[model samples]
Target: MGAAITRAQIVEVADRLFYEQGFEATSFADIAAAVRLSRGNFYYHFRTKDDLLGAVIALRLANTEAMLDGWEGATPDPVERIRSFVRILIMNRARIMLYGCPVGTLCDELSKLRHVAKDDAAKLFMLFRRWLSLQFAALGREADADALALHALMRSQGIATLATAFQDEGFIQREVEDLLAWVEAQRPHQDRPTSETRPQP
Candidate 1:
């Protein structure tokens, strides 16, 4: 593969390994082996795990921005936009059950380790928070948009942590339903999507 392709493969593999095994537990050798690259080759791209961690965070940030943009483009209704955020729990329930929230888990782990990239990793949550806040603001909740955004973000993290601990798909589904209900409650009654209009779970 070309150098750019090889570098992208390394970052992608490292991101998965970091999410699945964790930043501290996963080592250079693990990532190099996963990408089938020698130590010298891996070092050519990343001399330290921290460098790789930064790349991984950058990758996530870009991916998340694209996702948020997609949601914004998918609908003009802010309520439905918020619903799109909530439904991610249902859509990624299986992965959440296995690994917890990738962003949450990585942030928590990095925090515990006092890793320098902890704040950088947390930018992922900040991205979601800002996006959700905008959706809330669009829904006429500008006065407490950030607060409402944090509420949804906090609940999703709590659900993901518990889902991973309990390994219960039903719990995920139930919590997702509750979350969607909460989103609906945030909407002004006059602007609420009707039963026939709301997307099914």
Candidate 2:
């Protein structure tokens, strides 16, 4: 008998193939072939390609939320938090470049799929943006935080797009590092205390 395959295993394999080859280009046969399964077995897991795509998107979103959870009870300083977030992005550059940031990529590609799907994607992006906004608000720089997060998101997507076009990892890495530096500079000096400490009353 063959090894038992789980739903998650199917989604994991499909996600990689979809990102590398693209949704329109990756067929059910290709996905099944990657998993060493029959096309009918694939159908047993996912009724249709669209259905599979939706599952993949959900999986990606869950993974992101999991990452966010790890930062719970993290530093209250917004600047530091934001910097840490950017570092996380830098560390995951490869996955970001390949999958194109799940929320951003899905919004771009699956907007026309269904009203519910589009709505879900929009909500997910908004939630992440709002979390960034709250972090900036904590630093009393809500306005700048909003602008910075938007810019960072755009720059991140731009890097992923460039990766696809130029096939250059160095270019993407440099761009991301530059963006992080720019963000750090934008932070207020008051947010960073000097070595000299004032005596408390």
lDDT, candidates in the order shown: 0.91, 0.69
**Per-candidate total of colliding backbone pairs:** 0, 0
> TM-scores across all candidates?
0.95, 0.76
Candidate 1 yields a Cα-based lDDT of: 0.91
Compose the digit string of candidate 1's lDDT tens values, residues 1-201: 899999999999999999999889999999999999999999999988899999999999999999999999999998889899888888898888888899999999999999999999999999999999999999999999999999999999999999999999999889989898888878776776576354433
RMSD of 1: 3.0
Worst 10-residue lDDT window for candidate 2 reads 192-201
In terms of lDDT, model 2 sits at 0.69
Candidate 1 accuracy as TM-score: 0.95
Poorest 10 consecutive residues by lDDT, candidate 1: 192-201
Clashing pairs in 1: none
RMSD to truth, every model: 3.0, 5.3
